[model samples]
Target: MPVARPETSDARVIAHVDMDCFYVQVEQRKQPELRGLPTAVVQYNEWQGGALIAVSYEARSCGVKRSMRGEEATAACPEIQLVQVPVARGKADLNTYRSAGSEVVSILARSGRCERASIDEVYLDLTDAAESMLADAPPESLESIDEEALKSHILGMSREDGDDFKKSVRDWICRKGADRRDKLLGCGIIIVAELRKQVLKETEFSCSAGIAHNKMLAKLASGMNKPAQQTVVPYSAVQELLSSLPIKKMKQLGGKLGTSLQTDFGIDTVGDLLQFSETKLQEHYGVNTGTWLWNIARGISGEEVQGRLLPKSHGSGKTFPGPRALRSLSNVQHWLNQLCEELYERLSSDLEQNKRIASTLTLHASAFGSKDSDSHKKFPSKSCPLRYGVTKIQEDAFNLFQAALREYMGPFGTKPQGNKKETWRITGLSVSASKIVDIPSGTSSIMRYFQSQSTIPSCSTSGCLQEDVAVTPSASESCSEQKSVETQAAMPEEDISITDTLPDLDNSYGNMDMVPEKDVSCQSNDAKEFLTQSGSNRGTQTKTNGQRINNSKEKNKGMPSIVDIFKNYNATPQSQQETREDSTVSLTSKRANLSSSTSHSSEVNQEGEDRRETEWGYKVGEIDQAVFDELPYEIQREFRSFLRHNKRPNAGKSKGDGSASSSIAHYFPPLKK
Candidate 1:
């Protein structure tokens, strides 16, 4: 049911552009000799000379129609030429026709906001353009008009008067002080005529158009004139145009709804629907549909044209009717592979050209069972996360089909055995990719960062660097290395006084207050014990050289403490202090201290045995909730996994020992005894 909008008025200027016998025209362009001939495009000519999908107007005059067999078309029109659709991977390929449609859309999009209604049809909202033209360039002020603009069929004007009709249409178009709605429609007519000429000139394609105040009337008028002409539905002429029109001829009323109106209510024409009151119609068809029917009978529709240029999804399917149904798993697999290959190619093209990716893959199938009761059961459709590459798609599709087959077969039926006769036959198969989204900018930089991290060697606690066999530096690393060299070459050399820089470092270290030696040793011992306890529980930790040295404190007792090393490097000898007047010796001593401090810091920061920092360097409980939430999704996942792994033992202990408090104990106050 359609709902009427509040702004249902004749203030808008809309046009519907439809190609003239689109498929036939595409074929005629390919074979120049087929131009101006009675032609029909067919598919699968091997089966009863194929079926006609599109028929040319020249052939339609001879009674050749769509869905007619190729042989029947020839019998109806002896000289009719039939062209078969291109076949690839055992299926009909329509890429040629799709590409041609894109060419036409590019030209039509220049005049207004265009919506691609179908491959060969488009709807344009020309309200703004029409208003602008009427304001700046009125039709009456023009010195001359295109001959094509005068040929448009005006709805209210009768053609029985011939010259008078043309004069009336011309006068209405150029009439001064006319209704604003009429002026807008007149502007739309000229714009559509120009767009049609541009399309034909640029793409060698002929199209017809209809100009009206709304989408419904625009679509209704576009088809009124056939081939390469256009029609305009003026506001004053809408009533007369729709009064005699059959109810079945309306857009949404062509199916069961129209049949019900005719048989149930004995309604034959749009005028007949006017007799019923709104309340009475609502009683029969519900509120929305009743209001919609009442509004449309009076030439009032509020359906707006959507602004879109490309299709939301792409699908390739083939049906096996009657005896041609697939009976075995191998046959189904063979067809599925072909369909998957086609889908993969289209997805790859979209990703490359439009920078878009599809997130979902869906499979639809229709089948009938050998049993009379089971024949009516439907094969449920299934969808999964779409993965790129042809082989992965095929594998996933086959698995989805098997999953559906199980549910469709139910309890009484089992998997079809190869040695036994099959109980089910597949009648149709199709695979579609949807949920397309554009790839974000800077994705390449993110990918490069991850690749660089993967190539670096990882270190273990056993004092060894282990390189992954499969990992290696990629092109991004090579590019970065080249950039480093270029930057180094571009920099200007500067002279530095070593004496001046050495004193700054010495004074900075001398003034810093250091941790007590006893406190440092105690912290180291506590960390070692914690690591040992954690390693014993995990059963995977290895002892480092530093840990071994700490454990043998009684044997290698002469080893200097971590605080002693830093103090010795920062301390200034009394002899040097006494000889401060000797500038050369003072400078030498300062350089020695600076070098020692640098080496100590480097050793503390090294990987494996000398490294004192833990992997995360912070306790899980110390992490702030607000700060943790700001991390990227991938990093958050890793943090969650680490938490789960470390908390498992604690969770088990709390559950087994009744003395442990609950995990949520801190959330509430203790209950009164």
Candidate 2:
């Protein structure tokens, strides 16, 4: 649930902009012949005629809808072009639309503070711009209003013929003596109109916008009109517009919360909600939500548009329903690898372009037992310290799935074979990289100080395979790499200086839990809160690295597995120091002076023996010095440990094993006792 903030002021100007059939527009832009034709963007055409994710206005006119399947759309509009969403690694890739949205954001951000609400939606705080325009060039004094501005659909205006409606809108905006607040809204509408035009001119895309005093009203008005139009919610029309508005149509209340109000309180509209007192609503919905309900009842919302242009996290996932379920561990691993590859590509782009790094790699899956009727368990989500490589991600993800699988299948693995059922069937799988933070620029000196530790040895440089592979095609495979190239192709040719200033990608808005003003179910609400609510679905421990150890007995029972490859890959020297101290205190002080070098006389440390210790078998001497220096101390230790050749009884033990590397060898710590 979203926490309610202080009461919102009615004087601010906020605008919400939504692209018209964004995916369709992008596809049309790519293939101009498809423009003005009935079209829809679908994914995975092999499955039930494919799922329609976006529908063009022309298709809508022919009775086609986004909810329809590809075949259903064709039946509705025979001429409809069912464009497939780009596919890579056997899953739908939305990066093209995402990049296009980013282009739009770069333009919209010019007018004021902009918040990217989703892939194709944004909320802009144009209050300052509106106020400036109102003071500098009032709409009433302008010699001629832009024709595009005249096309705005003012809320509460009577239904009139096309020409008359346009004239009324024009006259109202250019009225000589309108209220200051109304004048401000008029300026906002003009600005939004200009922004929309600019978007079309530069990107060949059409969009709709709503201008009002706050985010809620603006969002409501934005959708009132269709493709390539704008709407304004004047302060005077707030009550009239909201009074007749269904409670389910308001943001945040469109789900079960709205249903509850109608079924329990007999509240059917915004006006009905006004009948309840703040105290009464608080008593029913808790203080925060109750106050929030009271404010929205009056068409007020304090939610501010955050100024951000990047997504908080990167993820790639696909759902496999019913018969399409994955039944084997190899099959699950294959899909997981694909998802990780896609995620790693985005993470790399973010790091390279935005100077950010994700700290956590999480895996989520939905599964069911094959034979056991009672085994309808959910696959737990698992997360581990994020390393910057595709192979690392795949290895970690496989381990996480294994840990989750054990829990979902119980201690016995699966139902008895006599029962004549499969082990498990995975219905959905997704991997995401989160807890992203900016890489501190101009900290080279500080980083060098840490790397100067005398015990550490110099190393050669190595590159990640993920960086070398173009997993998620930037634009489309057919398009030039320049348009969608998220790599160095889009960046300056010169090397960036450590102290050089870059755009701030760190500033972010807290997770907001706003409801859509539509009759959507609670599940819809949950999906909207993907960034916040997603973590809760994963039943794995959320502790950071080195904190806990997974107790699964199956972890190291066989030959070195994928999990063993990157075991303790994220361990830091600090953790190793802590472990050494703990051992010293527990026993005699003899363990305290143990050399960091692996020159002992044990068989695992035999003279002239050459072996890799780190999970990826990356040796400290062979690793790239520049990349190694930039890595966190924990990762540095991981590589150093891998370079060491120790043939002890626990030589193959994973991280979190105290006897292995004198540091937590387990990449994923188990749940706390």
Candidate 3:
């Protein structure tokens, strides 16, 4: 087992940059005339302008929300201009975003090691950049606090700006004698300030930045301000910022564990946790999580954001509301095809650019909570192996749905007990692919292994598998590799469901318990607070009070063995010609059943104008064509035959019960209790 390690303390300069209302800003920049108005970026304006995903700060104050329906947004602020998400492949496209992001990345990468966090966020390690600046010419303290102090600090700074000083300083720093740490640091600050300005000017994007010694603090501080602002988190500012903070406000804390903390120990404020011993906390939680909580209370976090230009998986989805409920499998199948098309196009792009191969395909469907939910077909993530292509995704996704439905048809599946076959309209559909890695075609196994080992990002916390990786360490003392052991040591033991994850503990919601907003019959509102609620009204935990039936097998297992098949199926996929032929036949038959069963309830036009053609697509390489071509023609034929035989299913009927906007983040607990 990998033993707990200490947090990194290495002195490094890291910066987190987030563009202000990026999509809105992107729209604003292109149109210019839309500047300063209460504008928002909507996803699908054609049909009620799919919900407003990103609203400007000005709009936010008007009760505008991310997933609020377009109609609701207009109701909130009558004058809000709803700009639609760029259309491609007969639906929303984000290529303009990718293009805009690349431009910003090129400029941000000008400093040291840079990591693009998301479509609108970036992290840069400025250690070398700062060192070089100091070597060539010292930094001038631009702000004047006092005449004497300012003059003293700027006594030897270079008069001019730009990266020139960086190169010049680098040349001299190597030869200069010891004790130049302070000197190097002073110059780095100057470089960062200038770099921030360049991004604003060059990219026409307003951004806020946090410069620290590590990734966590940088991320934390970056959100301090938005729309052209930056904050510097010196080691001195650590305690003041972290102390007295709400425990849930810390990143990774706003999940189930955070709720559990408040429930089990009444540890509300981060400072409150400080009152307890780390050992006691561990006893309450688990080893890893308990220790993690302790270190974070002390302003310590070691998670690193890796650098990557593309998403690990591409997904397209939407949530269903009233009047749009999918009542049949046909509706679900139709929507699934549209979604599959989007996923396939994205996969095509990845294959073209990175020559990478995706080994897994996942399906997420939601249904109103019921006995049907306990059925295998009723839950989301009924995923399977996906071939890379539009048709392939359609076929595979539908087959997986059928597979889930077949499981649903079993003995434990949904049964008519009270004539309760109320329409099972889907509220959401999301298709994604994973297991993407660069295809080092000609490299030997040993060589590839060594290359992978060598590729670890040079950071104390997180590491990446690629040459270009994000390794910026926060400036905070607690955000260090040396502190990793202490950080992990402070974690608490926990038991969480696999589906839940940590939520964003940001200004979006403060001290609020993320809860299920919709009133469902099974819920016990007696709980203190939920993510959707405010004040002391939230944060209470509920337990089953009634005696359990002897039927432990039924109550204990929430999901079926069919669901567990995901864990074992990957081990031995086939038994050669014997099962291969029969499996192929079964697969074809099943797919045929699914397609015919899922013929209606489709939405989202699959073909869009902006959808890139497969003929010329490549993601930094030629993986898509070569990888597929290299596979045995027989396998390809079988895959195609299977895809063709399995008809697409309706996407709407699979929609499940749930609110997408509820802030509750559920984290599976650590087993080291």
Candidate 4:
């Protein structure tokens, strides 16, 4: 449904550019011999000679149409040539066509704010450019205009008038004292004509364009003249042109909505809608849609062209219809691997060219059960934090599919009986990456800063944080200094040392909780044992013969203390004293508690269980405030943003005191006894 905007929106100049049989043109360009032939681009030649996705003009003239099988096309036009789309990883690859479209977009974007509507179409808001041209180089004032501009098909003007048609177009364009809107349209016409010429010269491709006051009319006019032609929708011709237009031909009205209009209101043409009042239409349809119908019926639309040149997301998928459906896990994994590999290549390219990263990986599958009753059940889609690398994406995507399969199968379908046929069949599979965002500038330096200060070992082979680095402050520290000491100790050293690349930051930050629930079920026995042992030894001292034993004098062995790391940096005496007092209190309290803890071993065990249950995964609040204050402004802002996103929910509900210790405690909740 469309929405109406203020009357002022009608003043802008808009244009729609559409490539002429884009896929066929791409194929023709690849093989010059196919330029004048009746050609069609097809895929999967094994099935009915593949299916025609694109048909060239010569083929269309010979009665060959899109969606017709290649065999049908050849039967219609005996000499028709079929070009199969390139195949990679056992699926059709369209990257060549996509690259050609990019070349066209690069030229079209120069004249205005361009929006790539699809791989083969774009909408440009040329209001600013048109206004400037009209003010400085009005078409009428020039002695002569480009010949391409003279070929424009002016709406409401008949070409049957013969020899004077081009002259008439020239006159209308250069007509003095024309309406302001009409003059703007004339400037737009010249601009688009030049852009089209540039595209042809540079890319060896031709496109059709339409110029008008708004996107709808421009889109409508662009298609009026085909194959390297341009059309103009004048303000004076809008009503007359739309009156005879079929309602079904309007944008967004070609589907069910158009059918409804004819079946419900007996409206077959745009002119038929002129009889109903807006309120009457609103009574049947909702207000927004009704008002949109009323306005469009009168040749009005306010949709603005967005200023985005790149797609918001990228996806790779394949379908296995009927007999081709996958019935076994290995079969599904094989196809999923191919799809994931394609998706990874696209993601890596986008990161390299655009300096952006996608945060989510989504897997969509369609399946049906062997039983007739289960055929109607839909397979639910699943998503998780996306990790970089082909291997990582493939593993995560497969895990996600397995998760969805379990839900789709339910308890009874978990394990099939021995030698029994599988009960479900997968018909479609797709993997997409989305939630893309640009990497912040200066992030490289910030990463380097953290890496320089790191003292612990790098990430383990499992990509988990090493538990041997003991940085937490003991309980003897005084309250005043506890916050600063704890803050410094809480920062995870693994976060800085996980990966040397910026894109991999998501791997650590996105799933800061150490392990995702889906992955936990699939961990090896060694990993599980490591987790269990680590959880028990977190805050306990060794004991022998019912007496506490000191292992070594080197308490902070793995990583140097935050205070020591920053000793060379500028610091106030007051802050240093506070840090020292906090460390002393924490250490003293731990020693006193160690001697009396045998009787409280059960309590200690219970406490450890509670810690395991409530752990928030990443220790993100461990940097000392004094240390943070010494960072560059950009780095400070980045750190603050990270904390805001990763902090646990309801974490600020702890008792509030205006001290740094309470603030640190707010993020890392204390365990209950």
Candidate 5:
């Protein structure tokens, strides 16, 4: 039998803080007159504009539900306020909402680990803060009357003083001479009350929370009493809670798995899952998922909650509606530019605040359903050692989209047979970055002053810290960095030494996405696809360690990452491409070869048929070793270290590979300062 390791006490404290009706709340906060009114945050007013992203609770009471068509909402509640979901530059405008989310997250992050899970959700590891607060409660509003009366009445009931108001409620339960069930219920109510008060006071926003021994339990409980309530689950209550709970309620058990549990194994409730053997589950689901299901069934999650405020990745996107849909590549590109710009601003902020760099860039587009529902496309992600300037980010992101589009259009189900309607309008478009890490080496100048006041994690020998985001080098400085990078790209192999700063290429591993269990983890949407060698004609090479990712569409399914592509992109001419002048011609030639010679494109051409062998211009196989050896010390160093960080975790290899392969695996393993 495999024993699950208990979550370590000091490992990390994670909290999932979800605002109540976030979009509606945003509107209500800005315009208090909207309070208690049936309000909804809508997007795309046309027939295709998806219904409400958010509707106030009051609207819900009035039979107004999210994703309800604006027309339907109006019909149900004539007085309902249906505000457009705001669009900017041809897409769903989310800037105002995102900004609001950031503010709430900043407030929540004040005392501990934090992650912004979504536009209106965040996670906090408030073990320290909670413990501190448990030591005291707010002063009474009045000294004489029912103020103490209220407190005493609260305390005398439960005859218990818990970590927070919950303990007082527990006492109330005792006063009622309640059973374990009643006591538990009282505790839950108190927890919700205390948390709600704290959130309102601290963030000027109201939120709901769940308190439990672990994240899964807490998360599950959090939703039970929503908006301005909290739920507490003691260790003893886990099994009872899971027994009758609907299987669908468990996170990650959506769609197929839920169906399978119901139809195949008759495991309608989480409790039923325990009847099957781990091996039996494997025989049904694949390996990775089977193991995951087994673990989650046992209430065991090895997931870590990251400590970050900025999104792990930045994404900008929009959906087209009705006749205003896209007509040509030019139109699509126009929208893509808008999305990329938004992503760039976010990336810039990350660089400014954390001095970190996004390791990859990816694009996604969904065409009109009337055109072809089968046409779900993902663009090839390209990344290079992330450069600081917005120009670099934008240029690279745009190019990556072109490459992805070429691949998606060709391999996926081809244009509806005979229907040449450019109305193949896109319903959604988004760009994201993944595998982000703090800038290499020490604290940024902005952070230096606060360094002594706060504790920072230790950095590698070369000095890369998780706290330093990339600084946008000024125009002249950016030019200088580029020249330095190009110069280093031209350096001789013999003259260069791969330092700890430089990620060792041999240690590269396929992309392994880490899904943070907390609010403050990596921000961006699966931080979109990315690869290296900027110029274009980019493609992908994959490696699956036999751990087949269950869903190919999900981000970071253990594929060779964009960084791996960059290493290939920057190869020296003698090793792959031939040299030009003093440096290897890899970047130039690689860009040229991007569209041609890629076999992977055929795979995504939708259906398995109608193959077209597009000739990408670059032949990466000919890039040289000297080119990599030569590069400005800083960029080269950063790239090398970035690779190292990503590869640190999976240092262990499969069966016959031995220690050499395992030792070569690069992972992003963070350690306490």
Candidate 6:
């Protein structure tokens, strides 16, 4: 289900560049002898010469296609050379091609905002570049265009006996008095041609590009011209190009969607789609998709090319067909370990090279029960928190598989513990890491800053935060000094040698709460800061613990602490009859508290002001508990210390807090500064 966007304005220049038979090109670069020959790159050569993933232009001319097996390709062209894709961990490896794609992206990114659409495709928004070119060096002023630009295939331009096609393209590209939009598109063509040449010169790879006003048009035009050539979609030629085009030839409508349009309304061409009213289309499809179809028929699309160079997620997987299916838990665990190993290697490289960490690990399996006649039972997919070690990933993957297996095999199906033969066979398995985030330096001690400002919310509207918790520093420790100490965690501590406590953190458990709860305490440098600062402020009177006790007793009773304010904020609403009475009482109580504690109130206000400056805010309910549980115990302990204040509650306090601490701190050492 795709949502329709606003109508296109054709104000931007977009280009889509696709590599021609990318896998074959990478192999050709490895062995120069295969450059001019009919070659095809295949994977798993042991199975019927493997499956052809890419076919050379020379091979395509000899009736060989990408879907054809190596045997069929060689039969069609006896001189055809077949190459196998690299294999690692019992699965096909595409790292070489991925690296090559990166080289191409590095070159293309120099022009403008570039988006890597796939391993061999990219979309670039060259609006600013084209506008700058038109302003600085308009195409009409040049005596002649670049040779590569002139070689572009212009849509709707007919080829005649006298080579009129080239002249038509040349005149249109350098048209003396064309519209500003057309001139901008011409500039885009020249820029794309230049980028293609750079890719070829630097990486020894050839590609084709399409220049148009939007991504859809660019994608359609890019495929029009094959291998080593570019195409330009002029505004005036758009109608003619699409009027007689088949609906299935369009970018997104080539599959089931196109078949639906043809079967439902007898629509076979783009021109036929225009016959139905927007309202009529809306009645057939939902409002979003209906309006989208109507606009695309008029040569309009508003999809923008995003600015990204890296993939959103990393995944490794393989399939076991029929007799090769995995039956025993040990067999499944072995394959899962291999997949996790590959995933971890890629993750380590990303962390080392890009300073990023992935936060979620997901497992997907394809299997069906053998004993049950209803083999249609589907394998459930499961995901957990992603940690940085290979052993952790393998453990988590095995857990996810077990969870999915339980759901896949219902009550009547064979259970894993049964002594009988295994009933469920795993035909495919995959593990992917997603929700990646970049880790910038100097963000280590953010928890101290939150505590110092009293900006931490003791209780949130979401039920996750309980209202009875309280955390407050000694009376001698002013809010201002706490702010200064907050900066300590940002750097290495000079006193305590608790270096092990600060193991390079990867991610916090879900969304970290702003304030600490009662009965929880941080014994890091931050806690010591309160002790040191309090002692200095009180004239260095007595022993550290003795002075702390005295300050707690002498603290002003009239001043409202963070805990009091949080309790008031979380107060329940009354019924309509008692609303007025409750409001009056609340107002009177608040005014009295503010007047007696003006300084403390000001600190609270300042904290609120600082929080307002943030770009995003989250509610406690939005946090995922399962994902949080999967986080490393060290991270969980640190985050819990920040969220809960150090306060020993009375005997009536809930027992749940102690249980939580015991579980999270089981694998973590005592907190040290």
Winning candidate number (lDDT): 4
Better of 2 and 6 by TM-score: 2
lDDT of 5 by residue, 1-673 (tens): 2223445644233456678888888878778888889898888767744588898888888998887898888888888987776776666777788888877776767666776767776665655554443334212211222221123222112334544554453344334544433343333333334455666776567777765545676678778766665555555567778888889888767687787788998888888888888788878786666776777676666655567788767777666655666655545656666776667666655654566556556666665444444555543343333333343344444434433433455433234343445324555667777667554333111111111101110011111211111111111121212222223223332221211111111112111111111111112323211221212111111111211111122112223322343333234313322222233223223222332233343332212111111211111111112222222223334444544444333233322423212111222223211
For candidate 4, write residues 1-673 as lDDT tens digits. Answer: 6666644644889999999999999999999999999999999758789999999999999999998998899999999999999999999888899889989998999989999999999999999999999999899889998889989999977775655887888888889978999999999989999999999999989999999988889999989999899999999999998899999999978999889999999998987999999999888778988998998998888887999888888899999999999987667778988998888878766765665566567899998788643546689787765655464466556656655665676545534224335677899999998877654343322332342222111111111111221221111111112222223234433222212111111111111112222222222222211111111111112111111211112221232211222221223334433433344232213322332242333333333333333331112233333234323334455545544444445343322332322233134232111
Candidate 1 off by > 4 Å: 1-10, 160-165, 371-375, 415-419, 441-673
Residue 446, model 6: lDDT of 30
The order by descending TM-score is 2, 4, 6, 1, 3, 5
Question: Better model by TM-score, 1 or 5?
Answer: 1
Q: What TM-score does each of the candidates earn?
A: 0.66, 0.69, 0.56, 0.68, 0.56, 0.68
lDDT of 6 by residue, 1-673 (tens): 5456774554789999999999999999999999999999998857678899999999999999988887888899999999999999999988899989999998999999999999999999999999999999988778878888878887766655344766776788788888888889889988999999999999999999998888889998889888989998888888888888899999778888888899998998887899999999889987888888888888888888999988889999999988889987667878988999889878776755665567668899998667555668689787755644565467557656655664576544433343435678899999999877554322232322222112222111000001100111121121112212122222221222110000111111111222222211333322211100111111112212212111112122232222222222224212221432333232223323333344344433333333322211211211222223433333334455543443223212222422222222223344322
Can you write out model 3's per-residue Cα lDDT over 390-415, one digit (the tens) per residue? Answer: 54456456545433443334333333
Separate clash counts for every candidate: 0, 25, 95, 10, 101, 5
Provide the overall lDDT of each model, using Cα atoms, as 2-decimal numbers.
Answer: 0.61, 0.62, 0.49, 0.64, 0.47, 0.62
RMSD of 4: 16.6
Which candidate do you rate higher for lDDT, 5 or 6?
6
**How does residue 433 of candidate 2 score in lDDT?**
86
lDDT of 4: 0.64
Residue-level lDDT of model 2, residues 1-673, one tens digit each, is: 5457674545888999999999999999999999999989998759668999999998999999887898898888899999999999888999999999999999999999999999999999998998999889888778888889998888877758888977898888878778878888999989999999999999999999999998999999999897899999998899999999999998888898999999999998998989999999999999989989988888878888898888898999998888989876657777887898788878767865676667667889998666644666677786655655564466567656655665676556634333334477889999998877654333221212221211111100000111111221111111111121223233332222111001111101011111221111112211111000001111112212211111111111121111111222123334433433343121101111222132232332221122111121221122223334334433444334432322123322322322222222223232111
Candidate 4 residue pairs in backbone clash: 474-586, 475-586, 476-585, 476-586, 476-589, 477-585, 477-586, 487-622, 490-622, 491-622
Which regions of candidate 6 deviate over 4 angstroms?
A: 8-10, 160-165, 441-673
Report how far residue 503 has shifted in candidate 3, in Å: 45
What's the best-to-worst order under lDDT? 4, 6, 2, 1, 3, 5
Q: Model 3, residue 644: displacement in angstroms? A: 31
